[model samples]
Target: MPTSASAFEIQSDFDAIDFAGGMIAEAKRRTGDNAAIEYACADMFDWLARFPEAYDCILTVGTLHHVDLTSALRAMSRALKPGGRLLVLDLVRRPGWRYVLINSIVWDAPASFVDGVNQIS
Candidate 1:
């Protein structure tokens, strides 16, 4: 990973933003590096639309499925600088009970946590 880069994390949910803040803090504490990271509680489309070609990279996790994929991708493309990267991690399939149970056991996660993974779609 590059030693220095600007990162913006956008999420409309306050809880998700809070969780990300905690994770960022933990990461900084462990790595002992102060990375430039900005957290914005805004709808992804609105934020991206405001920053045309402003971001070096755009990444979304478990979010695109909830919106119009084509529009979302276009917005991301506009937001990213030339040669910038876009990475998206989303649910490709709805998890069955068996898959959920196995994931819960393998990750040592609670039933609720596993269930929430199902909602990503």
Candidate 2:
């Protein structure tokens, strides 16, 4: 775990999505003998499809709220090797007061939208 943390780092950037390495042009900067880091630009969904093993550790901050949580977590599970650790701290279904507070913000959405939110929760 500590081995990969400081030795090398990969950071991805995309206009459409925030992720690791993106295009030939940008990745070219980090490739060849001059390459200090490998740059890859690919979607997480597609990327995970290519790797069937688990990761040593997966870190997600508040980002998972953008996608359907179940699907995302399943994908993460698929990519994770056995005993892989996935650490995530994101939005949660708040019971009582917090739930009411969040509902208030989405009150303007159509009823079906509200239902969809509930389903996702």
Could you say which candidate leads in lDDT?
Answer: 1
Q: Which candidate gets the maximum TM-score versus the true structure?
A: 1
Candidate 1 lands at a TM-score of: 0.50
Quote the lDDT for 26 in model 2.
Answer: 56
- Poorest lDDT segment (10 consecutive residues) of candidate 1: 10-19
lDDT of 2 by residue, 10-87 (tens): 653222223644444554644554434334465667767777663555555554555655566667667666666665
Pairs in clash, predicted candidate 1 = none
Scored against the true structure, residue 65 in model 2 reaches a CA lDDT of 56
lDDT against the true structure, per candidate, is 0.52, 0.51
Error of 2 at 121 (Å): 12
Model 2 lDDT-worst window of ten: 106-115
Whole-model lDDT, model 1: 0.52
